[model samples]
Target chain A: MPTIVVDVMPKAELLDPQGKAVTGALSRLGVDAFSAVRIGKRFELTVEGEVDDDVLATARRIADEILSNAVIEDVVAVEVVE
Target chain B: MPTIVVDVMPKAELLDPQGKAVTGALSRLGVDAFSAVRIGKRFELTVEGEVDDDVLATARRIADEILSNAVIEDVVAVEVVE
Candidate 1:
């Protein structure tokens, strides 16, 4: 079965406390290659059958409506994987 | 600054209750194109300089050791994004 992947990330303007905490932890652990860290979500939706236009459209709609919160997060990508 | 995106997903054998709930909700809403849904995490690490081999290595290490739990999750990808 094909799968649709949806990537959702917090708005760029908003503050990500979880990311900040991870950044601080990295610095404390002596991993300084990264300056900032932002966390997001990745959803894998398993399709029932072939990935057609209607399936892709449904995935997009779900990505925007249910997978992510529009006010704080954005649907960055919606791609199909075998 | 370049960003390294790390994708972490729940272990395939684990039962994902959250995903199950969402799947149920989707079916109840009349969206049945998908059969299963799995949730994961996406971490964006902002590098202070160019993404070199060493930076990529560090990101991979973090993705495995810090970003995700070995017992419950797997690091699926670590790619550089602009």
Candidate 2:
């Protein structure tokens, strides 16, 4: 099985309220060694059969078109992992 | 900088409505080669300075206690990436 992982996060320039909120909670919970916290969507897709360039392309297309909003967010990384 | 990526997913026995919805949308949009679709969370945390075992442990603790629900979900993977 081929697993496609799409990690989506807000653009670096934009302020992430969710991340900030999490950071605040982390501080309250006492794990504040983090300089920054980024919260985003990580969509994992498992494709049946062989994993190839076409699958990679489809994953990219889905990540770009369906997964993350290109305007304010960026699909920072997309890859196939074992 | 050390970045810890935590991938959280629902237990295999659990039903994932979000994943199913996405699968349905994919079927409608025409890209359905998936045997099973599971939706979960990926948390990206940035710790200041060096990334090490302590960081990894903290990441695990956070993933287990903070990011995911122990009852229904599982932290499938955790790693420190460059």
Model 2 TM-score is 0.90
Residue-by-residue lDDT tens digits, candidate 2, B1-82: 7788888888888888888888788878888765556677767788898887787888888889988899999998888778
TM-score of each: 0.98, 0.90
* Alpha-carbon deviation at B39 in model 2, angstroms: 2.1
Clashing pairs in 2: none
What C-alpha lDDT do the candidate models reach, one value each? 0.95, 0.82
| Runs with alpha carbons beyond 4 Å of true place in candidate 2 | none
lDDT of 1: 0.95
Clashing residue pairs, candidate 1? none
Best by lDDT: 1
RMSD of each: 0.7, 1.7
